[model samples]
Target: MKKILTILMIVIMSTALFACTTQSNNEIKQDLVVGLEAAYAPFNWTVTSISDYSYPISNQPGSHVDGYDVQMSKELARIMDRNLTIKAIEWDGLIPALNSGEIDVIIAGMSPTSERKLQINFSDEYYRSEIVMVVKRNSVYENATRLIDFSGSKVVAQRGTLYDDLIDQIDNVVHQTPLDAYSNLVAAVTTNVSDAFVAELPVAESVVKSNPSLAIVKLEQGYGFESEESDITVSVGMRKSDTDLLNEINSALSQISVEVRNQMMTEAVLRNNESELTLFGLITKYLSLFVQGVGVTLLLAITGTFGGFIFSLVLVFGKTQKIDKKRDNIFKKIIKRISNGLSTAYIVLFRGTPMIVQAMIFYYGVKLITDISWWTPLSAGLIIVILNTSAYIAEILRGSMNAIDKGQMEAARSLGFSRIKSLLYIVYPQAIKNALPAIGNEFIVNLKDTAVLSVIGVLDLFNATRQVVGATYDTVTPFIITALIYLFLTGVTSIAVNYLENHKAGKELKDA
Candidate 1:
């Protein structure tokens, strides 16, 4: 009873802290909070070091963002006389983030297509470029000049972008599944996962410049994919309610001449090509980031595993509460019934859904209710992991406890031990001894599963690899390093689990 009361107190205090941390500044915003993918080269990409061209990324410490998008955002913020704050977000999450009030504007080289105009208002055009297909240097598609020329070839693009939609324009093309980033598309083409990928002219140029083995196929003007003028022009994305801010942004954009815009893009392209590193060079250069990623991954896995174990105890107790008709009053029986129902519901709900979906719903859903400033990705990620993990661990504990003989509990009661004391002192210890291996497996599972947290911008190993890919434009090397790190972590964990199992078995034999 005391333990349950303490857990309730901690939960209440946490709720209070969460309430206290909410801030309501979106209505009267001070900073120009800009959101972008930061993985689209020349448009926006992440970098390790700060420069005159780079803007600090609010979510990623010790890293910065640079490219044409960042430069345009800088000018916009300066014109508005507001401090600039850039956030690196996944492409698919940008519109949702803007709508949920998590970000003020999006300058992520987003084309203001007719489809997007319904959800959010777009500022005047900031940049324009034609569509082009990128292919392996010596591939047959490299010489193609028309959409029909590439028929029967596999093609892809970044997921949820105009580029991906353009794939349908190619006649009889395989139309492979779109990837999540330009880096992934580049990798797909280079590694033969796909024959080609559609990209904007500047982006194609950036990829070709970074990779000598890739080439661009620019179709004849009349034979190219038909596109609307707005489809080719990138604009600032903001909430529909921000009419005044939209006009002000357009005013700031008008101040820059076409010549200056071209010049800025040229400079950005040059800066994007500044890095010339081999795989080994990139690994050495970005070693610290990999280390930081490993640290965050381990932190989430360890804490999530231990924290889930603790919470699962409470869940087990709730689900297993006795409904004594004779000794229990009507109020007590009702409480027990409710507890069992809730615990069962919680386990079923969490176990039934994927963690990726849960993370997206929880992370974005929280923003709808409170100021996003307090509900950060890491905080939300930890809570999600704990809650999801508790459901599974509860069943594990319950099954392990039940496997023990009823004779043990009856004997304890015969010795005048209370129900709680008997379970805690006699039954739980042996159940834990039986369940240790499964609990250790949960830890290992967390070490790998936490990679999904990256979708919600948790900065786990996978997210770190994506950041490195954004900076270096070499997708293969970063992922290889990340895989190795994951292997090392899981390997160590497995060895530890094996040792604990062996030790437990040996001790039992000795006691016998």
Candidate 2:
């Protein structure tokens, strides 16, 4: 056991040393890092194939991003004489990523509204598009000609955008909760969860073209949304401190004529709508992505479960240590009290909070405090799962410890074993055996709950499926594949854990 612990310690120390050494080199790389939500069509989306127009996303192997934004980014990179690097960040995370220096600019068709200007600076408009409402072809709002025509109807839009704010323009509008992605809005409208959703003219055209059941309500003159000019124009976002880089990007944009930009956008729409394959074809085309996603999911679950088990043991010992009030030194008593208080707080805090909330806080919070390039989404995810699982495992271990007979401790003491040795070798081992089933359940739970890590862009199973949905615009098939993969993983794990339980039981019977 001591030899194994020594090896583990050495590996951890080496990894930390390597990370610190490589961070500086990564920071100094002169690539132009551009962040975007690849789920948006025409503007940006993921593709399996690489071409002159498609750029590979950083750290996500075999996944290429393509769209007008990607082409524009490539042009800007060429103009600035730098290699372009694209990151498929979630919409809500793009600004945070840019601010944290994870990405140098945001080219995600983001509008530079007054509210957003306070946080980050924007370049001159790269794309100007009119706002339109997308509705079901058979819905009552399909024939509507103006904003007020859909009054008292259930409307929705993508959250944290100008479109979401525009839903209130209709008097007595039943505005629904804004979703996170355009695909989600598509689903909402298609499923009748919402009457209509606000979208830019190009996006509406692209969506309507692909989804025959959908239609766009393009209001005539004097019937559209009344908004500021900035709300209708998309721009590249950068840090307020990056005035020099922003000016260079604007200069590059100035060189591209409006006619050329429109041509690029038209080409994007055509390319985006070209994939008319059936659902099965999409699954077959992207099968490798699902396979990779499963591998990452399993890695997170296995590492988090075993790592958490080890840490839970430490927490259990800390929280359960008993200081002799009469004979122990004052120093020992104080140390024991502090350790117990800390252990209790850790378990309570982690257990009480949701894992998704914890993941966001840890991922962004760590980036906020220390801008370490080595701390990727996977690392942050592992830390979150381990911390969360340890809390539950600690409680399980505590109950298991209480179930053990008190005489076992006395027997070890009688045999001249120290309290630490008794707990480590005899008592704790028995407690772990008793808690094995609960620990196994925690592992299975981790396998499923790792889906939440997608919010922080971990590229786990759920995120992979979302990538497929973004590419194909078919939500049902990809999710079905994801569910089956999860079911297979959990089922196999259940069998393995049951085998271990039975083996332990047989070993105990033989000993008795």
Best model number under lDDT: 2
Candidate 1 TM-score, true structure as reference: 0.91
Give the C-alpha lDDT of model 1.
0.87
Positional deviation of residue 353's Cα in model 1 after best superposition, in angstroms: 0.8
- Specify the poorest-scoring 10-residue window by lDDT in model 1: 20-29
TM-score of candidate 2 against the unseen true structure: 0.91
Q: Which stretches of candidate 1 lie above 4 Å from their native place? A: 1-29, 274-276
Candidate 1 per-residue lDDT over residues 1-512, each given as its tens digit: 99999999999999987766654434344788999877788899877777899988887666678999999999888877777999888777899889888899999999998889999999999998889999999888889999899899999988878778888888888989888888888889999999999989998888888888899999999998999898899999999999998998999999988888988899999888845577788878777778777888998999899999999988988898888789899999999999999999999999999998998899988897788456888888899999988998999999999999999998999999987898899988888888898999899899989888877677777787887887667788788888888899899999999999999899989999
Q: List ranges where model 2 is wrong by over 4 Å.
A: 1-29, 274-277
Clashing residue pairs, backbone N/CA/C < 3 A, model 1:
none
- The digit string of per-residue lDDT tens for model 2 on 1-512 reads 99999999999999999998899666765789899888788898878777878988885767788898999999889887777888878788888777877789999999999989999999999999999999999888888998789889999998999999988889999989998777788888989999999999888877877678889999877988899999999999999999999889999999999999999999998888844557677678888888878988999999999999999989998999799989799999999999999999999999999998898788878887898878888888998999999999999999999999999998998999998999998899999999998999999999999988887777888888887777666666778888888999999999998999999999989999
Among all windows of 10 consecutive residues in model 2, the one with the lowest summed lDDT is 274-283
- Model 1 residue 233 distance off true place after TM-score fit, in angstroms: 0.9
